[model samples]
Target: MLVHKRVVRLNEKPRIRYGPMLIRDQERIANLNYIYNCNDIEALWMLRMKRAPFARLVQTFRSRGLLQDSIHTSVEEQVAMFLHVVGHNQRLRVVHNTFRRSMETISRYFKQVLYVVGELKGEMFKSPTGRTPTKIRTSPRWYPYFKINNIL
Candidate 1:
């Protein structure tokens, strides 16, 4: 304990040089190339949706006048990052590493996409009506019971 306190020049922390993506301009360009040229399957693998559906979703967002490209990032990339994080249950740092973005960028865009998509999601989920649907009503097994209900 005495030696630890007496140690000199130990307080100067080493300068950390971040590797690859986070530090270079070229890496950011490559990130664009990745999603832009990636095939449907690859897009699905990374973003949890195929290229066509991804494009359509972006188009939907654009058409609604909700989201737009930022100075440093595009709407597509923003959405992709958002989807990748949520779809894979990843943390912000994971997304930052994968997307080659800073934590701030990842968080900002994630929130943006989340807010916009959440805003539009109301259309997908309608209020439940107090009625049995045609499928349930028509299906005897489902409406009445799936099993014998032996306990009852």
Candidate 2:
């Protein structure tokens, strides 16, 4: 048996440039501060993960007075909570342990906020203009996988 050796290009240094940091505009900064200061863990989580849905949920909750007397958690906190949950997908107890809050509180707040998000997403998806056309005519063999996959 003959053995062959392979040569590798190991001397190529990657050209990397660190871009300058971008500062937020005054209005955007103010809005971010307001959201960060005013939202709760659940609210913040929904906002960060699904901005449009979160906004809709917050609006609905505000209109219904559901959040009027609730604790003064900032939108930023809510966003942070969402990121934490998404990053960990752990149990409620795990979330509570991580967030330093009781499981009951986390569950209650998360459910309420998520309910609103679900409703908003449903409504948005139900709109006729939001859907793709059922019949999309394409040339035969243009996408062979489409025929193979029975999608054509």
Q: Considering every candidate listed, which one attains the maximal lDDT? A: 1
Off by over 4 Å in 2: 1-60, 63-69, 72-88, 124-152
Query: What is the C-alpha local distance difference test score of candidate 1?
Result: 0.82
What C-alpha lDDT do the candidate models reach, one value each? 0.82, 0.52
TM-score of 2: 0.38
Q: What is the lDDT of residue 15 in candidate 1?
A: 77
Local accuracy of candidate 1 as per-residue lDDT tens digits, 48-151: 98988888889888888889987888888988899999889999998887777899999988899999978988874688675666787678779776234423
Error of 1 at 69 (Å): 0.7
Quick one: RMSD of model 1? 6.7
Clashing pairs in 1: none
| Each model's Cα RMSD | 6.7, 18.3
- Model 2 over residues 42-94: C-alpha lDDT tens digits? 43453444455556545665776544335644443443444456655767787
Per-residue lDDT for 43 in model 1?
84
For model 1, give the 10-residue run with minimal summed lDDT.
143-152
